[model samples]
Target: MKTDTVITKPLLEIDKSIDALVKQIELLSFVNPTNIEEEKARFFSSKYLTQPVFKYPDINFDRFKLHRKLFKQQIELIEDERIKNLYEDIIYTYSGLIKCIETIGSGKKFYYNSLHCFGTPTEIDVENAKYILHFEDEDLDSQAFAPKYNAKEAESFFRAYSEQYDFTYHIKHSDKISAIAMVSNNAKTLVLNTNHVYSDNEIAVLTNHEIGVHMVTTMNGLLHPLKIFSHGFPNNEETQEGLAVFAEYMSNNLTVTRLKELAYRVIAVNSLSKGYSFSKTFRLLHNQYDLEKEAAYYITVRAHRGGGFTKDYLYLTGLKKVYDYYHANKNLSLLLTGKVSLEYADDIESLIEKGLAVPAKHITDAYAENSNTNKTVDFILKNLK
Candidate 1:
């Protein structure tokens, strides 16, 4: 360890305890209730083929409840009032994540709990997706980026992207998830779906959004004196994902097709609260919305995967909120301090003043002034109602 580490008194002690507490709060690795691809493949190969009914991975509910109680107890033991409030928010967020995990395998109740956690898409949100549905972009309609690259080739691209920032991480191939980037136990892993072929937009978006923001913040969190910085703040998903999507926009790779995909996700999530079935949601996107059948299948699976995960709707919601924040001339650097939320900008500032946090070691590349390439996408983002 470096000698320059500013080991403040009780704050450092609090940080150590919070860091240890977060070990049991692993969300990204086990967020999905089931391995969706296997279910789909099994359904396709059956003699009597049928719609896939997903079975979630078994989580230790009893063990998690114990962890929850411990986290609550930890929050109560903190001495400083401001520090205590910060931890109170952190513990609250982690507790919500725990509830999401516990409720995953359950059906409509899961949807109800999810809505309680990540709010349901509003009437305007549904209309925004509908408006995006009718948008006809001849350029995006062409499907210019062919799916030709294999897993090894894609891995090379990801490695090259990481190399640009002196980032050290591992790349793994699996058919389990489309593509997910995670930071766990001081190790970083990026998993790719080897079964699906890649396109330029798909590759570029992941490069900027996942690597540029998510990984950047992950590394920055390690630099903090507080462990809560690493675990994330309450409602961090909306801002974190918003920042990731904003990175896509800043890098000049965000497309109408991609934005429409996010819109479709909001629509799919909206269908869940309305009690739409798997086939019903798929038909709503394919027949009614006129999405490609292949695209429709994935969207339905994502929204319906854990019986009713409403989290997908937040991608669009986050994008809008982040966009508005940026346009308002708010400080994006505060968000980059760690896996943080816009709601706690003041808390972060306070930490910096008291030597509990430091400036971001690796500044987000997307935050640099942009070239402003796509006007239409910019216009829509600007006018998102």
Candidate 2:
């Protein structure tokens, strides 16, 4: 006997309501604290001699609490166990996000959410950064370090790639971000840092990382029956970033400098867990390790922002997991099913089988071609512990 499961009308209404509420909670838009520009100026004005003092943006905890109440109420009303678990996962992710917003500027409180949201760097993570630190690259040689394009040039190059996919998005300049793809329910915008110098090849790498995966996933998620796919699953950061970096590799643009940047992020993030202050982390990278003052400052600001951010360490970790999984011949389609988690690939399969989700509308063109021909890069990415 075949029993057909019916989705009730009330469930439909609840899904729509939850989607609207989640859209209202713009995590990234709110997470970049307003004081970054001020602090960056302060740090530079002191000629890298003084610690940065950051001012956090105000978050309305009262509104967030009320929304959480409504989220809990909605979750309680869900009849399907699998769907209920998904909703619960979203609520937990939201709670962590709220904690991150509330704890900004406070060292202890922000570290709590940083642990919950991104996790502390493990001993393995610490060792990986140390190992990568000693790497000598010819690419770092001055004769090979010509950055021909600035942000405007980089943005123009990105536009060509974006046009190929018929992706309509906006480019915005920011003093804070070092080129980020911002995807929300209603907008797709890439924020480029005017302070960072970009090369032609760097834009290609960013094209693959930001637009190829992030923006493609954004458009794909919009075609889904549920909105959670668009917003990202719990801990979607790891897999999404891994996939993006993989795209960079597939397109033959992943460089040793990029890998070193990821390594530096791990070291800086670990410094936070070890109770290092902003100046302490900066000195460790700049004075002790001899990283360029500009690059060192960029790395320090990321980990020390909001007192103790640990999110940057996940890039290397994510690269390892996604590459290992791909090397095993698992279907990439499962990963491209919108902003998803590798942990929940099975759940995504179940959702597709149940007709709750569809196959990706726009697969990344970068991944469609096998162009990563660098063996040394492959060896390092594959062998990372």
Candidate 3:
């Protein structure tokens, strides 16, 4: 063996640090099991109330204000874009934290509605050149997300979408959609758990917002030079969700009632986070907000049902930020370039023509051509002026 054999490993210490930082960033993507358990105990523990009460804690008042201060300091010290991106990530992360904390502490629920049968089709009986339509209802006896829908139809939907987008991978259809984006053994494909909790209006709003923007960005990012694009940009969910809700507004699908509903949800979820029972929150929205019991119940269930699911508050707050960006005429073409809403359909359409955000690769065909959708579209198109 040669005495002076050359070493192959890189000699850069900064590279090692960079690698370590990248690892830390990746770890931030998924929830930690220990932290999840601690959060669960904090919510479920009977001693939560008696232990201590936070009286307008500084942490509670401004979730990310401190984080922003810290970020500014870090940015001053760092020159690398990766490290800078980390600060941006932290800011977005803290925003969700603030909303969750506020939502949990609000002590109001029961305004959340668990509306059923949102995305599924309505049956029509035609007579004398007139079509009579009926919205379907969920069957309590069935454990399906929708009434009598099959995976075959789900396969068709995704397949058709794939063909339009000129790409195909794996897809799994499901009767149940676990909102948790975790390790699900059910199947490897994107699941469509379309039991109708949202309305036709809500469906259009979510479709553009969720599938159109969120899912579309997901797929388009996959086609990028970096595989991470598919994974989503850093701080993706906040941007994605905020953008999605904004799309609905751009398309003029976002209603005042929906906005107010999100506000109520923020209050409801915050109540649950602060240890209020479902009944108490339900009563709060019902009594204070003048929401009916059924409406209040849905809001409460969404907030309190899963015991500390304080994530719904982002809808309204996100909508506000997105709308503000739109009003300012920001580089929303980037916002529109993904599968997104026409929140400001006209503004978005301009970008689409320029090949920024692509047009929808898929529209729910079952409803797209229907009289109901046509009427809704017509109303929206007319009002756009």
Q: Which candidate is the best by lDDT?
A: 2
- Tell me the spans in candidate 1 whose CA falls farther than 4 Å from its real position: 1-11, 41-51, 60-65, 71-79, 138-144, 178-186
What is the number of backbone collisions in each predicted candidate, taken in the order shown? 0, 0, 34
Query: Candidate 2: where is the Cα deviation over 4 Å?
Result: 1-5, 8-11, 35-38, 44-49, 58-64, 140-145, 178-186
- The 10 consecutive residues of candidate 1 with the worst lDDT sum are 1-10
lDDT of 1 by residue, 287-379 (tens): 888888678878888787766878888888888888899989988888887888888888888788777788777776777976458887787
RMSD list, candidates in order? 3.4, 2.8, 13.8
Clashes of 3: 34
Per-model CA lDDT versus the true structure: 0.74, 0.76, 0.41
lDDT of 2 at 298: 73
The CA root-mean-square deviation of candidate 1, after full C-alpha superposition on the true structure, stands at 3.4
After superposition, candidate 3 runs with Cα above 4 Å error: 1-164, 169-189, 194-203, 224-235, 286-298, 336-385
Per-residue lDDT tens digits for candidate 3, residues 246-336, read: 6665565654454456557667756654567655776777887677765665566555532345446555444555656655765554543
TM per candidate comes to: 0.89, 0.91, 0.47
For model 2, how does the per-residue alpha-carbon lDDT over 1-385 read when each residue is reduced to its tens digit?
A: 2212355344556666666666655555655655666776788788767877766556654665645665554666667788788878877786677677766778788788788988988999888877776766534445334777667777888888888786587788776553333434346777777766676667778888888888888888877777778877888888988998999988987777778889989999988878887888988999888888778887887787776878889888988888888889887778888889999998888777777788877778887877987776787887688
